[model samples]
Target: MNQLFRLPQVGEADAIAEPSADLRVPFAQSGTFVCKFIIGEPSDQAVCCGAPVADGKSWCAYHRRIVFEPARPGRAR
Candidate 1:
């Protein structure tokens, strides 16, 4: 039945919005990091925000508008 397979209520949101995939940075040694957005239902998209860091601290980028160093001259991420 549709009810059995239906997904649980996520939250009050119309649709979850995508995150800025382009905003990526270098992760410590050789790895890379980037900011990501956690989409929810259709009513609210700002479910969660975070940036992949080397240390492993997933902060909320939505509430704490992330401010990273501008990409070098030509490089953009």
Candidate 2:
């Protein structure tokens, strides 16, 4: 599979070194933008599949279909 595009952190001078793959996309850090798992919206979902979550995600394991990989194609399947 081809590598997926992702948004890099904003306001970072070093970010210019490796420009973000997608600039139109914006990530939420809390509430609606934040993952439901962390906020306890749904405990049954598996956002990262036992893997450390990123900025926003909702899930732990044996639940939702979100998994994290080094070179993830894109969001979870």
Candidate 3:
């Protein structure tokens, strides 16, 4: 079989570059947006993700990865 792929080669310049805020998904809903990850039973719910969002992000760093990055092949959500 023919080889079809090669690993990505990131350079120092690429790593040092600042990520553009425009690439992030915008939060359109009113009020403060929090990580949708819930805690406790439905009868007693709470928002314990972290501090209020900074830089106009929708979810925390953890949830942000889940929202943007593509899931690995053969892996369950």
Q: By TM-score, who's the top model here?
A: 3
Q: In candidate 1, which residue pairs clash?
A: 13-42, 13-43, 13-44, 14-42, 14-43, 15-42, 22-77
- Please provide, for model 3 over 6-57, each residue's C-alpha lDDT reduced to its tens digit, 9 standing for 90 to 100: 3343223234332333333222322465444333333333333443456667
The TM-score values for the models, in the order shown, are 0.22, 0.16, 0.31
Q: Write one digit per residue (lDDT tens) for candidate 1, span 1-77.
A: 12222234323222434345444333222133333334343233333334444444453333223333323334533
Candidate achieving higher TM-score, 1 or 3: 3
**Residue pairs with backbone overlap in model 3:** none
Sorted by TM-score (best first), the order is: 3, 1, 2
Q: Which of the two, 1 or 2, has more TM-score?
A: 1
Top-scoring candidate (lDDT) = 3
Better of 1 and 3 by lDDT: 3
Instruction: Kindly list the per-residue Cα lDDT of model 2 for residues 10-76, writing each as its tens digit.
Output: 2242332321233212223223332233322433442211332354445422123334433444545
TM-score of 3: 0.31
What's model 2's TM-score?
0.16
Q: What lDDT would each prediction earn against the true structure?
A: 0.35, 0.32, 0.42
